[model samples]
Target: MSRLLLLSPLLLFLGLAYLLPLSGVMLQSVTTPEPGLQNYSAALGDPLVWSVIWRTLRVCLCVTVLAVVLAYPLTLLWLKGNTATRVLVELAIMIPFWLSVLSRAFGWLSLLSNRGLINSWLQSLGIIAEPLTMVRNEFGVVIGMMHFLIPFAVFPLASAMRSVDDRVILAARGMGASRMRIFWQIFVPMTKSGIVGAALLVFVFSLGFYIVPTLLGGGRSVMIAELIYLRIFQIPNWGLAAALSALLMVSIGAFLVALIKRAGVSTT
Candidate 1:
């Protein structure tokens, strides 16, 4: 009872700061432009809206996959390394967190553009006659998003890997378990929670990403969040924007619930 009382303030703060704003946004989605289900109907009926949503999902999926693939090997290395080496690797990962997203996006643009560093070097080496179309497309978006998301995936996985006792692996080896068998039977299962958590985090973050996709993707790729922005700021269609925002929130919620269930089952 005392602990519950102590947490009441935090709970109240969340209710006021988080829940209230979210409810207001939801309400606005439904109530705006004469208080009907028209906005939701429009959202469902519009093919363009569906396309944007699908694109957002696709981008998020790609980013999550890339982040997880890269993170797994890095996490393993970090786990096996000495404390000083692990700290250095962690610091390298943390460097991106200090830089702004726009800066990083611009950095990617510099490297990926036709007249950029890669093209210049390749041209000088006579590797190709013309520059590659790397920036302002899906390729650039994926690359930029992966850069941002890899650290997110790595930290959780490394932490989870660290939590897994080294003794278990030694015991399995001592019992004559093959390397592949031990990894599949022990390490993979142990780190499932971290993988799921990292994937969820990356997916959620990428789903709503605006700057990376906008700068790198050009007009070829349109994410739901960007569409929502266009509706609100460009087209001034608040009702539709709110509806799209609500849909994005719902989708994110569903993914999070699924992740929680998977984590629960794994733990059980």
Candidate 2:
């Protein structure tokens, strides 16, 4: 078929560039250290590995939730606003998505540091004699990640909200449904797919984050990606690094499957 021919280039590219490298990693993870599952077994038994994985999942979940909450109101504003306001709001969201990841990470570092703008303003206001610690911690990582992910959440949420039929809302309002009731019952339910899609997008990307977490986490909150980097570059533990990568890939696959199942079963 023409479609099959059209897909050949992408298939070839993935096979050569992506799949080949992943296969190498998979092979290296098991075979380089005497061809057994010992690497995986050790990684599973290590408490540190579990800690890093849990931290990664927790941060990603926090970022996903925060992004959805932050983006939803802005999405509503954009939906209800005049043409000019909507365009400006859209531009604001798109700007961050367009900017470089490292640039945003450093910007967050500058803003969250003890001598940074936020702390300086608080100090000037006499909020506290001692500057509160903000940077190089889990909080800073969450902030940076939310900054990166909010726009991604916004676009999909906005599209879902837009897909909602305005006439249905008006009809509900006419039938004496409260605005809040209408929104809760109608708007949210209709947009579930978009919300899930956006959340999944944010969650997946957050799990794989390197630059933001590295800059903001101050080596205190070790994520899986950072763990991988440390293994490969710092300790030169290729077998362990490959094992971690493989395990992470499997975990991601399982998580996605669980999400799909949950989404399917949920009626409300």
Q: Which number leads on lDDT? A: 2
Q: Highest TM-score: which candidate?
A: 2
TM-score of each: 0.93, 0.94
Residue-wise lDDT of candidate 1 within 185-243, one digit each (tens)? 99999988888888888888888889999999977888887899999899888888889
Tally clashing residue pairs in candidate 2.
0
Scored against the true structure, residue 62 in model 2 reaches a CA lDDT of 96
Q: Per model, state how many residue pairs clash.
A: 0, 0
Candidate 1 clashes: the total is 0
Mark the regions of model 2 whose C-alpha exceeds 4 Å error after superposition. 265-268
Query: CA lDDT, every prediction?
Result: 0.88, 0.90
Residue 213 in model 2: lDDT? 88
Write candidate 2's Cα lDDT for 38-138 as tens digits. 88988899999999999999999999999998899899888898999989988888888899999999998888899998999999999877888898999
Q: How far is candidate 2 from the true structure (C-alpha RMSD, Å)?
A: 2.4
Give the Cα-based TM-score of candidate 2 against the true structure. Answer: 0.94
